[model samples]
Target: MSKLVFQSVAVNTDPMTQPTPTPALSAPDLTEIQTGRLADPFSLLGPSHRGHAGHLVVHLPDAQRVTAVIDGTAYPLAAQAPGVFAGMIPPGSAYILRVGNGSPENGAQEWEQEDPYRFGPVLGELDEYLIGEGTHQRLWHVLGARVIRHEGVEGTCFALWAPSAQAVAVVGDFNQWDARRAPMRPRGTTGVWELFIPGVAEGASYKYRIIGPDGRELPLKADPIGFGSEHPPQTASVVRSITGYGWRDAAWLEGRAEAQDRRAPMSVYEVHLGSWRKRGDRPLSYVEAATELVDYAVDMGFTHIELMPISEHPFAGSWGYQPVGLYAPTVRHGPPHEFRDLVDAAHARGLGIILDWVPGHFPSDAHGLAQFDGTALYEHADPREGFHPDWNTCIYNFGRREVVNYLTSNALYWLEEYHIDGLRVDAVASMLYRDYSRKAGEWVPNIHGGRENLEAIALLQRVNTLTYGAVPGSMMIAEESTSFPGVSRPVDAGGLGFGFKWNMGWMNDTLRYMEHAPIHRRHHHHLMTFGIDYAFSENFILPISHDEVVHGKGAMIAKMPGDAWEKFANLRAYYGYMWGHPGKKLLFMGCEFAQAHEWNHDAELDWAALSRPENAGIQRLVRDLNTLYRGTPALHARDCEAEGFAWLDGGATDISVFAWARFGGPGDDPVVVIANMTPVERPGWRCAFPQAGHWDEVLNTDAAIYGGGNRGNMGGVVTEAVAHHGHAQSAQITLPPLSTVMFRYRGAE
Candidate 1:
């Protein structure tokens, strides 16, 4: 499949007259070189193959005369063809080629430069072997533009994968964007082209100029493995070195495994950095976020900070979801190192960081991976398998071994290089199904005639395996909505290996129930309790994500069915119930302070609203909730286990009051959570308890400090010996109107 093609150094792109044959060169070889195939440009352009010592050749198009400078002595070379020159200088002597242009009457100008074709390859045999087998875990190190010393010359070693190309040239600012010079050499049978261009160091912008197999020049393409890029609307890859960052998260890294365990409380504060806050007219840069954002999250008692995708994207309206540069942390917020500063700041404060990783699909931008190498090399040719109609993007060909390797290695790069704590993989449900968002006949079936996409499933599994194996304490959470079993189970158990799955069913049901008026909530009571049916099926996170507050969904506060006062009360009660529920927690940025408007990716959050008493009260309630959740073992220790929870009064649907007990290990104390969803208060109403003892009112959603009337059981309650609701002990407690209350048991004396 690897056919040889010749390199062209034609001075004029329009057809040129065939030069008369010389003793040193054949006409067929000259024709191929003039056509620009670049299969082995080194053989045709750089040193003599006819055993003539000190014989140097270079293709300097448009050069009227060429001279070799050795030891400050200039020697003229005879022109073999148009723009092609060769001559003998001192053997084994270091030299530079001086290109002379213009006529003698106008005065000639000379430009001296090193010959790019004189440098040997940076990619050795081992890289080729691993690349051919598609097993290179560190593919980024080899594919992208790496600034290094090749052949005793300081330059950048550029490589690309375009097997079907007739010729590939490195075109950029260094070479005045000329495609004729610096043609890449295709390694035998590897489909990879390599060229080391001297003096092209960091910060130089570049793109690949490729002539397709049919000799058709394709659009200049961005590097798929590029670590840095020019700010968008300008689609050139910038050479960057991502090494030598001194990370300060050694303590956090050592304790991360325990911090991410199921037993640990994971209270995530999800943020869209671009909209979380602003400094005057623009969003905060990564340097600004390092202190402002990290300080805010720690002060609010969040365990981790989950940022929406920050990868380089052309359109800001996509909110970073349709990323073009997977390796690049968007230049919108400073360079890659500043992003590291943000991560380092979080870890310094003992907080974990998680990024929303999108690997399912990408935009069909001209400079992106779509139609790369003038073929469907990264995506599938079939639309049914490779197109995402909903997003208007192209799906990656996970079935291709090399493509899979490329993606899998990218996962490790973030964790290993950036020291990020976790990745919440986005839109996993779409990747799991072959016919996602498609009707019958518009979709394709798998080899087994099923709807499951086996390749994508394998890709997801492999990514989870590799990331977890490489990063000890890192997590791979899934944004999956389907009922596919064992989503959080291990891969060896024949399941998709994820650390946690977003509890979409619980979110949808609970929000639907909360939307109904208090009077009507009794009839729709089953909505809130239905989630308990499969609550412990998989490790879950009760997420109030950005998706819930955008595109006409309204903000969290608006979703409540009540007047001004009741709205605040309802949200506080809901937050109480959510924190007490059996799962991890994740709340979007504005939700903590009850932002009035729906989320807009373009603007900053309405932070001034926090000055209001009601809004400040909501913020205080969330802080206390996080504090209580983390401090109390009974509240979080058994979040993923059935035995850790017990319902006392699920049949209290008529009263709209629910009570449950959360237990820890045998010796650890238990906490009781009671939620009164209705507006009506119940004074001296006997509620069941696990034991006959004095229970302290640990948290009261209706407390006066939280913008509610100070109405609840005073400090503590003592249980009487009256059997009630299948318990030997019952407490005569006061239930505030539309509130949630928590109690901690001391002992039975």
Candidate 2:
């Protein structure tokens, strides 16, 4: 079998439906690309300067007589002005325009030792950019041309923008670093260097080296908008358009979209594929990863699957945060299209896909966007706008028009190009702060000197607005750790406009309280009520993020108190409480089971933890939690929708049990949830329900399947109820030690 033997199947959302129309890719106009025609320059150039137009106007001053030299043919300028020139030039072609000084008294001049007009703007083919002033021109041709595949052609084209280089050669894993074997030929009039490799196709990595005027050959340069990487010393990745994959998730996307529209409960299983599992030998392909993990998520009953940074990163363990190329999915995991297939497969299984997009910072690797076009193109020029000290990365100048478009284009790229349903913006706090990771002397204040980063804020707001406007179903999630007000609020309503923000404080406080509480006095009366107090502040996702379970913090299951049994019980109780709380939920990999060690990406997740009943119990509890969430509306229906929930009790007997009613008719069943933080089981405890009759146990953290003592109220059975509360009949319920129980009852419905 050949390398290109993979199938190219469209992952349809409707198996019987036709595919959607392809999006448009329009090239810019021609006159906007040329500064002056190479055919005739003497008449076009004035006595003073020569100018070209693209996004910005470049003025070349102190020029004398100008003439066009192309294919050994000369064209004299008609003297449009003394030395200034104006004419049209076609894109994808190159011609030389020479200048020499005339008489000084005649307003003509010659070059001095350090003359500024000695050089002209280098012309190269420009890739279609959707952002910046370049958007106005609509198209550009700088030093390179798009090298597209031709049918039945066993060749490749080398395009570049090196007008000053004496020669350019393509090298890499393909040519064995030999320059002479593949010398680039000059094409038409465009400065583009062209070449065709007879045997090289997709997946064959290659790079280009430019031989300078001094006869020095530089290494291959990474594509400015490449979607993948083999970074630094490594050549640019080979092309593999993602129009290929075997996907089966068409129905899943439709169902999931409907559920999301209905504001249904969503529990996401966040994974870092490389870290999730790795055998000792070769890595698992994307297909294998999808097969292995998709079923696990479905079995666990999670409604969504969130992946960590999957964009191509050079390092194996940077958590995909230090992205070198935004266009390429990490080739380490697999090809670009394989990731799409994985997502499509997941969607087919009723799972929503959320990507971790890091536009806040980029790595400083040579093959990355540190500096492109021989300038600070992708970043700001000064320390005030360019660098991130904490992560040791490069910060994009969001204030710049091109920068805004770059990131905004990136935001739309994943959604439009890869069919991702949502983005979880990482390091939002860093993006929002100018003083982030900076000491007094190191920090650069904004113009107002108020510690506010307006540019970043504007960029985020634009991102949210543009992302939501372009793709209504796509979600904008923020990992903003600080108390950034209105993180989940709409932009027009004086908020940052994120659909959801990670509830870091809630996670930290709850975990701290849970870990410190003694089994006997684990009452944590004050801490247990934290969720109800600020739950309405924003749309939040309670995350047991990878940050919490790594770097010696130990596993979430290990955060529980006491012996193995107690620990399992404690974890179940914690999860049960979190689920019942008024927020959406997300669990990092390895947290589903009670792994013994902190997560290590280089190592496989401790699957052996399942052998331990305590660990297995935690996993079962999570699955049960997902089921319960789907089964009961009282838990998650009110999370993002308008005022769908209210807390009836906050200080109820140092136990912090609360009552909440989901969005439904007034006569619908009201869910009564009770949590006993104290190790004292309130047996035969009477809790007041809104209606009379009996209430069945929907979910119990102490259930036997979840590795508990099986002290649960039987389901589907009716019982007599007694009332102690005002104006309503109540039911008598049994509360297990350090556990939570939820019951639905509405006038015996």
Q: Considering every candidate listed, which one attains the maximal lDDT? A: 1
Compose the digit string of candidate 1's lDDT tens values, residues 621-689. 999999999999999988899998989887788988888899987887888999999999989877899
lDDT of 1: 0.87
Worst 10 residues of 2 by lDDT: 111-120
Alpha carbon lDDT of each predicted model: 0.87, 0.64
Sliding window of 10 residues with minimal summed lDDT for model 1 = 1-10
Cα distance off (Å), candidate 1, residue 524: 1.5
Candidate 2, residue 497: Cα displacement in angstroms equals 2.7
lDDT for model 2: 0.64
lDDT of 1 at 465: 94
Best TM-score goes to which candidate? 1
Clashing pairs in 1: 6-37, 6-38, 7-38, 8-33, 8-36
Q: Which whole-number lDDT from 0 to 100 does residue 667 have in model 1? A: 85
